[model samples]
Target chain A: MINIKKLALLIVFIWPSVLLAETMEVTLLYVGPTDSQAWAGSQQGLDEANLQGQFLGQNYQIKSVTMKELQDLPASNMTAILVDASKKNVLSLAQDAKYSQVPIFNLTSTDDALRSACVPNLFNILPSDQMDKDAIAQWQAKNPDIAVKAQAWHEDFVKFAASQLNKRFKRNHNVNMTDDAWAGWASVKMISDTVARTESIKSTSLLEHLKNDLSFDGQKGDTATFRETGQLRQIVLLVNDKNEIVAEAPLRGVKNGLDSLGKTTCQ
Target chain B: MKFKSLLLSTLIMASTAAMAEPSHRVFISNEKSDSVSVIDMKTNAVIKTINVGERPRGIGLSPDGDKLYIAVSEENAIAVVDLKTLQLEKKLDAGDDPETFDVAPNGYIYLSNEDDAQASVIDPKSGKVIETIPVGIEPEGVAVSPDGSLVLVTSESTNMVHVIDTAKHKVVKNILVAARPRGLAFNSDGSLAYSTSEVGNEVTVIDTKSLSIIKKASIDLKNSKPMDIKVSPDGKTLYVTTGRGNSVAVLDADTLEMKANVPVGKRVWGLGMSKDGSTLYTADGVSSTVSVVDTKTNKAIKTIEVGQFPWGVAVDD
Candidate 1:
């Protein structure tokens, strides 16, 4: 009798989520090579997103597309697109009027000009060149004698569960997670996270929420959010040649918050 | 001579009373460093450091305050530490990947097994697993109700708080919360419970009796991804550690309104409070420091550097 009662409770608990699940058909378009680092990261993100989506009563599908096939994409039906293309292609894709409504996540490009473009539809996951330069400058300003450079992602970054992410990526793809991969993963994860939390699948609403409401924990110890420039304000790792993450941009003692790393106000 | 003797007697009595005062100490678990730093609360200084074990995260004191339970995650065990001697007593099996946990009034160590998606209730006296209750996936936070009737585990991936019936050892209800709810704290009377959501960027207030959400408030500060939560002893105020906000937020308990965000070290996560509820000790993970916040002033009074990646803090008064 006790087992029956417990079983009833379990059914009651599991039934509603399964029954009421909206079955939101969200397609996450990836405009990149399947063998690339960014695609591997994005693939892992999709897998994790599906896991999270199951609980949220949503389903996410990834469609690998090319530059030529961009026009063939179900622009109206798709929820979002993540790009791992060149700076020119990214800008052109964002500027294209056909997919203007679809939110585009630039997964690989780090051109400062892209951020300066301030395309409303485009959200750059990779920090701009200026953001990296500024981060390194901040660290260099403190230690004038030591020369440092900026990095987007490092496999050795143990904080904020980066090690777990790296391990999972390596296990899934048989390769170390790179900067592009982190960006790709960040894009999918951010979209899935926003959709799950806000329970909104509409492109415009997701874009608005992505711009204003969402705060992503990009496995970077702190809050990584989108700025007015449509670029993610994230910590840039000061990685040296031995591929060791020596320090972070917005270097602890010198600069203030994450905003110190990137352009906050649009010109 | 009589007057001088009387004066000496009074001095001795005062000294004895001072010594009798509850020895105020704060023990912080440094996960990456594999040690616990003991701080003398009166002076707020690191008086001693005990090498507990690898990946020590969750920490709590026994009901009698005689022992310390540290969740050594990598080893999948709880390190029993004799507080008096500041030494590790033994490691008790706590199931798989115990990250955070809470101590019940009944002196049972309730832990969250993240990897297994379960909460294991261990009897500290005998060092035995009394009951293992199933819960949601990636259960990160374990919070026991003030009355010890419920053991709540917040699962990160599942985004639900599974409330375990202490008496029957059954999962009574599953309460849905925001994304990545990592920490939880109940009011002084257990009438209400507060939880912090890391990715959702909100603090949810739940009616403990109803097992329903009362309110959800967005953290006001920029990059405010709240991690751990603590309610003042009086139950009128809440101290929430904002993860990426890089500060501690003070909120009105009833209104769930953000009152203040006090600046602290980078990536502050675990929180412990003094017996008087006048001070809060925050374990800053990134900077590897503890910020001692005076609740009255809503400010960080001192910063004490600890071992690498300080995770959880347990205070004994």
Candidate 2:
């Protein structure tokens, strides 16, 4: 005979699905042209998330919004928000009373001041300007003999676009994917990972996962996480003119551990 | 009813007889070579190399000791190897990018899906997924309590250990540990668990019932990248393989103090012990060898060369 308590437990677990039917909605707020590279990159993440959702048994629907139209939408309907705008503008949106409860992902702006502002709802998937600069500074301090230089991508590589991100973007859209485009892709990927883990797009659980429980895979060894300061702690890659990774930071003794790059502790 | 009881007793005796037979052998999974190196226990020599599949990371015997389950990371499956013939038996879906797994006493395998950020429970006999419990990011290490009532999965990126209720298939508690928590082992009685965080350069001991970290232990070895940990059958000593430190640091279980660091091969990652608890083995990834350490003398007695990137080790007899 089946145990009564076991039967009761089974019924309780199964009964929830019968009661609630909800779909998570992720909003992508872009200030620029909808057809731009950054928009395309963020969309790539949404597509990847959707593909992974098949295995995870979660549903995520994306809604793209322009800056002028964001005010018209109800903030309560948004499960999560991806913001691509200037630092000041993104911070304003993060602090906006209507969207204050939503988890906001900053994809474009890399301002150090934005990170210092420490808006609880704001999350930066891209490295802050301070983080990037600190990474290079730490590397230079470690290896003083080696010369470092930066230049725009050569026309050939841009035209050919042999990198995996570039190749995938080119194959999908018939154009090279720039850094801004990759930022959009990465931002969505982070959300997708969170959704896969939580199975909920609600801001509270998603934000908790992002801040504390994320071991997000940005395709670079799966050791990425968000800092308390709202910076995504990732290794800074020093790419050569040919797009080869010459060096990576959070270099030995530059900082400790794989979870971050610089100023790891946040308030 | 009498006949059924008689038959059950006969079957139990037969199984016990089979287990009593001496079958001393050590198996090491080589990640880069995509093979398992079989070592002769008495001679401390690798007798044969059986090619399994791509990127074999974690290896262990089933609870009954009849089969070996190897986590092939690249294939996203667990390659089941028959112990008697030491050949490939079957592959079971272990979710995408399976890093390691722990076999439960109830015939379920709790597998860590590294890329998927979840733990998938599969029944080896049925080859069906029972459930997938969402865990922290980059889940790497899994340990099921001996009683089979609890499951612990450590996420390297999230730097947390998720305690799962086996029957409920849900995370009951999330215990924050050191950074980059990689490998874990439960004591014989399941009262405590030891976890290693490579980047944090520390090992945390969690009390099972409380689901809280009671102690954090570290040895004074320079550049210590502690990876896999194992508890002796007596629960007196804790054996930790320090990855880059190239040594095995033996610690006193009661006090959580380091006793000795026995030198092993370069970048040692996996730890295993003999059934009698007399000897220990370390899977050295960088040097591609297995170092046999004598528990009595606390010294590495033999270094048996194995395949490339030797990852995990398991001994069965």
Tens-digit lDDT track for model 1 on A1-267?
999999999999989977776487778877877888988888888887776665556788888877788787667777888888899988999999887888999988899878889888899898889988898888777777776668888888886667767777887898888899999888888888778767777888888888887767687765567888898888889977677788877776654578887778787
Candidate 2 residue-wise lDDT, A1-267, digit = tens: 369988898889877875454444444455555667678887766666655453345555556777668889877667677777888888888888888777887877778877887888888776666667766676678777665432112112321112334545566777776656767777777677676556676767777887787655454432467777788776665555456555666667643654435455555
Q: Which ten residues in a row have the lowest lDDT in candidate 2 chain A?
A: A152-161
User: Which candidate has the top score in DockQ?
Assistant: 1
lDDT of each: 0.85, 0.78
Question: Measured against the native two-chain assembly using Cα atoms, what DockQ does each of the candidate structures obtain, in the order listed?
Answer: 0.13, 0.06
Clashing pairs in 2: A41-A185, A42-A184
Q: How well does each candidate superpose onto the true structure, as a TM-score?
A: 0.77, 0.65
Interface RMSD of each: 3.6, 8.3
Q: Whole-model lDDT for model 1 versus the true structure? A: 0.85
Q: What value does the lDDT take at residue B207 in candidate 2?
A: 94
Model 2's i-RMS, to one decimal, reads 8.3
